[model samples]
Target: MELWPASLAEITPDLYATEEVESEDKEVVAKFFALGSSLTWYVVEAQKLEFGDVLFFGYVHTGDWNSEWGYFTLKELEQQRYLGGIPRIERDLHFEKKRFGELDLEQ
Candidate 1:
């Protein structure tokens, strides 16, 4: 198994290349334990930008977390209705449409 960065945003290309090699050789590595599945992964970490806080990227299996699987902002997470408001579960209806082409509800 080999790990390599798939892309570079701009600021550091050489750093990404070097990191890719380290990641592959296991010198530098990352692991994610969330949503139940243990995943070996990497993250760019949070960066402060001119507009606001920015987080690069990371990935884990869908089964790791029971998320509806879509893009979301931290603000949205804070505003989610589950602990109070409209309920995040309802939001999955949209994902059902996007992923399965329809909301079966039965699943």
Candidate 2:
């Protein structure tokens, strides 16, 4: 995913503790977004993984707990900390006939 060019180098850090101390965590998490009109796009998911934790986040964001916006994952999160920050971007990955994993991380 494309993080806002202005975002910090380690835009996202220590999303949370791992299975060593896990729970069905859910909260209003801020991720570096490259699209739309904000430095970060507030999305929801089962988890917002950072570092080498390769896994897909879940859907369902909510103030009162009810606003499913689909899931996002972290592949290059660890490989390139400089480009991560945004989890589960929705830049036409579904409508553009493209897969989320199709995004280039070689930059």
How much is 31 displaced in model 1, in angstroms?
8.3
- Top-TM-score structure, candidate number: 1
Worst 10 residues of 1 by lDDT: 90-99
The local distance difference test score of each candidate is: 0.28, 0.33
Best by lDDT: 2
Q: Kindly report which residue stretches of model 1 are placed more than 4 angstroms away from their true locations once superposed.
A: 1-42, 64-107
Measured with C-alpha atoms, the lDDT of residue 50 in candidate 2 is 58
Q: Using Cα atoms with residue i matched to residue i, what is each candidate's TM-score against the true structure?
A: 0.27, 0.25
Candidate 1, clashing residue pairs? 35-64
**lDDT (C-alpha) at residue 102 in model 2:** 41
